[model samples]
Target: MRFARAIALGAVTAVTGGLLAAVPAAAQATGAPAASAAATVSVTLTGKAVRADGRAVDEVGVFVVPAARWVDEDAAPVSTALVADNGRYSVTASVAAGSSLYVRVDDWTSSDGYMDRLFVGKGGKAAFTYVGLAPIAAKAGTIELGTATAPKLSTVRVTTSAPVHCAKLLRKNGTLAAMECDYTVDKKVFTFTGMYPGEYTVGAMWSSWTDARATVDVSAKKGVTTAAMLTLESPTTMTGVVQDTQGKALEGIAVWANGPDSPRTVTDATGRYAFKGLTAGSYVVDYSGASGMSSAYRDYVTRTSTVSVTSGRVTTAGSTLTKGAQVTGSVTPLAKETYGTIVALAADGHVLASDSYWSSDGKKRDFALHGLPTGTHTVVVQDAASGRYAKSTVVVSGTSARTVGALKPAAAPVTVRGTVEGTTAGFVSLRYGTSPLYRGAIDGGDVKPDGSYAITHVVPGIYALRSHRTTSTAGYEGNLLSVTVGDGVAVRRIPQPTRKVQTLQTLVRTSVTFDGRALPGVVPLPRRTPADLWGNWTNEKGVGQAPWTGRAWDAVVLEDVFFAYHSPYYFVVKSPTSVTKPGDLANVTVARVAGGPTV
Candidate 1:
């Protein structure tokens, strides 16, 4: 395409000015005079143009294509209009009483990641339909063409037992860029338009009837519409506190919810972690514990179960994470003529500790990997811009680390080109080195809008192809790809799998407890006044929650007097359905949190 931003002012003025502008004055004066009774045979074409997701599409060009030929003239457009933000457009054209036309959308750029400019007309597989104009005996005529939808994304409908409130359909990479909320308050089914065919997760907010958030994975097939069915269940909360072997709080530690939903958050100043709005399910709170070059000390984990969280209640899954060995190191790039460096200590392709070192105007690279898991790990380092780097493997004893003195040079340049088809706006990476922990990059760049990408000047060698969305998950379907490229372009199709990853089912939340003390999960600030809980919430009024952020409060009361305390309520769900009291669930065994075997 041809994209014309706006019609010229003079042409528009003349067309509206007199008959000489639209047609010859002598012909109009003889046959049909402009703005006269004979020329009053006009047709108004109007409609709303939209994207697949039901969002209004603006700046689309609309045309009235002639459906029936006139005397010696071919079928063609008699008028045009531009779609507005509300997706509405109106065009008035003068024609004979029996003249007919089809409403067609003209060429325009689509923001929905289509490579080519849009060509949506009759029989183009467009999601829109052209309306046929009929003869009008009245002076005024109107032809309502209804709605025109763009043919970009596939629509996925989520049918739930309860109406999903404030629900959003998340993409495979767990980002909102693919499709946000097609919220339904009381409707049982929610339709999410503007979705590319891929795996997705659908979740709803707090519901009055059932406790669970009704989160489910939709394994959308390629070119197939996904209609998912999910039921609501009881909802619950999980909380815990992590501390060092010396009983000191380890604030700012990363606590991950390893289950159906992998939502992660950091500990507060009190070393307490809280996970709210989760369906009752089995879950593990993996804390950042002792590892790497520790000061030659032994490590151990605590006790834990088939933890159950009850509906309309908070379940405490407290965990005591004893600090592990600390590993630290630095990176010194070989050359300064590059972008930056990403140094990671990876074990089994999972990054234990990672940090980036960008080139300053006059500084050298310094990267450190702290608390690397015990045993051996690959220290992968590469230039961010040029993809040149080095790697080495080292074994970590009790808290320990080693210096990877100098970096290695990158390989020769090669061109790797391929079509990357997925909803993820991800990039294709040409990586040279790989460990179970991480893939060391050689060079990488973004995939274009046309589903194609080319990494020029890549070092010619055998490299692993990794396509990744914004999230940690690689959007591509298959395993790590291996390709051999010479000095020129190498073509490959990286198939993105539509595999449905199973999330841990919701069970009663459980926490490991020893010595009769439950682990403290929800750390609450002191309740100072009535305004803190009731209303007039202010961030600066010393609500006792200044330093702590991202905390999920169980409940606040304005009863006699609201006094903020320091500790959150810790409730551990020993069992959900079987346990009325603490003694009813002795059958569900427990594992002592001891030193886990080093990988």
Candidate 2:
């Protein structure tokens, strides 16, 4: 298969010149178009195309493909460029901010034969070298990819026992590459050429058989084809019989295999139902359509009454349907609402069925839910307009209609107040449970500077008081505080998660003096060698500047602060240290004011 071919540039929208102001000067270098910026972020990739032996390569087609669409067959590059004879190339692509992009360098037409490499950044680390790893975060700047070494490409020959419908190759780093099955041949082979040297997982799918997956490693040389064999397993099967509690066969009962594909069928005259072509796994066999019979589920094999099918084997699960019960309830309108919705939920919180009631006068309306299996269910009644709701648990058994007395919906919502510790700048909302039938924030409030927040008009129910900090990225969620709100005012103190210290450093160019004195009212700074002077800093106020001959002295003064998130340097100050080189400041140390912003 052809790996690299000409791609049309029409798909890439042209960036406006006004957006070029944000492009770095390095992107405007010769042999490449001047970088332009617009509403979308732009990444300027600069790299050298070299052979494995480090020789400059010419005529190499370098492209930046969006990582999200890399597996697509017709995915086009956002930007493409050819390697200069000097091996250096630069390509700029306008992409969405924070988006990831893949850098691919290829020259399949060369006499060297399909030599290619995918740029994973320097030292093969996923770290951001201007742009981050695999999904290179689309930062609007230049990404200095020092060199891209095109080692001889390798191939992966994937084979399977059954006719493969499709296949996919997954890299160890979670990069997916689609592979085409060789249908013209035996249909069992999927050859992926021009693969980078690494560990890859090969997956093959068959129409009526269980799919297969195998891991293989492709070598780092040309003419080497890694062989991977995926032996397809036979599809699993589940057969069952549905009968009445009296041991009589129940014909025409729908037995549903609630597993992959959710295959369903009706029982024959013998009360036997079979479901084939299923993957090996646990299955929840359910039968519900029998007249007046209770719905049931078989989750295990043998005495457990459930089913789990294995490859080429059959698992049997027979269910005996009993008489189902019914539930009847009346919802009393707490306010002026005339209609309400009634829902019956299983113990697992799945809605069994829903029914509505309407009344011309503001009086109680009746509702009925039938065909409930022998189990515990929570019946809920909700006012359509006022958002008031009430729920009660009912036990359903036998054929009688269980009557739940009238349920009065809750009255007006309540006011909730709390002290939000740790962060003082975010919003506080409530995630209500289903009993209230309202999930969103009826009313959310911003945390005051004093760390107090109040949410008004909150419905009465169990809720999770969620807090967020908009101050910094280090902001984390406090432990979920489950609160039960009633008609009165509720108050609680929620402590936010602690903030971790992030070490930040920046190079500060200044003169250092060897005066054995410390600034007044300031504590002695941490003693360390000049090499270890770089630490966390918050701000810099230049005091003075003087020209020093010799090697320009760049002194690093480390300070700890709470406001620094982005940027390398935080705090800077000018002192009377006159040193030619960084080594001259071996005895120099700095001090910080007591209780100052920079500790």
Best lDDT among the predictions, by candidate number: 2
Candidate 2 lDDT tens digits, 1-599: 23322111111111133110112323321222212322477678777777766666653222343321112212455677878877798888877565545565554443453443333432322210112222344578887767666555567777776655566665322223445654322277777665544445566644223344434533323447778877665546677777766888866676655544456566766777666557777766656553212233211111113468887787777887665677887888766547767766665344455678877777878887766767787887777676677878899766667988898877565678988876677777775443222223345678898889998755555667767664322344455567877668999788864433222223333322211221111111222222223322111221112222233334433222211111111112234244454344333333211110100
lDDT, candidate 1, at 11: 8
| Models, CA RMSD each | 25.8, 19.1
How far residue 49's Cα lies from its native spot in candidate 2, in Å, is 31
TM-score of 1: 0.35
lDDT for model 2: 0.50
Q: Cα RMSD (Å) between model 1 and the true structure?
A: 25.8
Instruction: Work out how many backbone clashes candidate 1 has.
Output: 55
Expressed as tens digits, the lDDT of each residue in 118-172 for candidate 1 is: 2232222232112111212223577665666654534667787754444556432
C-alpha TM-score for every candidate: 0.35, 0.34
